[model samples]
Target: MLYAYLLSVVRTVAPIAAGWLITQALRLGVTIEPGPVESLVTGAFAALYYAAFRFAELKLSPRLGWLLGWARPPEYPRT
Candidate 1:
């Protein structure tokens, strides 16, 4: 479903954004290929961002559910 695809994309935002920032910072005033350190730090930052956003969405659904891939709470069926 498109919703699932959207969630997948949303989930990557944190890692991608963090990687970009890290790359830029690492490249400052020097030229060097990315290494394990960059990757490890980026991964950690991504995980933190993902957890925080998901927590916020959980605690404040409907208001911030779209932050990082929330399936949205189920709705009751009307009779």
Candidate 2:
């Protein structure tokens, strides 16, 4: 659980960090001052991108591995 939590944190932070770095680099060549709304939009987009990537990763990986197997499967009672 802790490993999964850490992985999630890393995934969530990485894109934001990269975006910040890219914006800083662009600042050297261009005068771009983003407003609060623009920053919020950018952050939301980054979070969506991370979620999509994580979905793809979960779809690709096997279900019976050590990472996923740590969680117990849901039990649905018969109707």
Candidate 3:
């Protein structure tokens, strides 16, 4: 549980970092300016994106692990 929780934090921070990276990229490529308000809004967007990603990952991780052969099946006793 704690591992998952911490992972979620990373999940949350990843989008924020990605957003900053995007802003940097856009600043380099285009003349569009980002204001303080937009930065705050982008932070919110990043948080939301992180939350959704975490939720989705939680929902899908088990299935993905099984598909990837990382999940082991339970052993059955012979009748």
Best by TM-score: 1
**Candidates by lDDT, descending order:** 1, 3, 2
User: Residues 25-79, candidate 1, lDDT per residue (tens digit)?
Assistant: 7789555567966987898899799778777776766656566656674465543
What lDDT is obtained when candidate 1 is compared to the true structure? 0.73
The C-alpha RMSD in Å for every predicted model, in order, reads 9.9, 12.3, 11.6
Question: Candidate 2, clashing residue pairs?
Answer: none
List where candidate 1 sits over 4 angstroms from the true fold: 1-34, 69-79
Give the alpha carbon lDDT tens digit for every residue of 1-79 in model 2: 6776797999999989998987987788965566866997898898787556555545754343334334333455543
Give model 2 RMSD, 1 decimal: 12.3
Prediction 3 global C-alpha lDDT: 0.67
Where in model 3 is the C-alpha error above 4 Å? 30-79
Arrange candidates, best TM-score first. Answer: 1, 2, 3
- Kindly report the root-mean-square deviation of model 1 from the true structure over all alpha carbons: 9.9
Candidate scoring better on lDDT of 2 and 3: 3
TM-score of each: 0.41, 0.39, 0.35
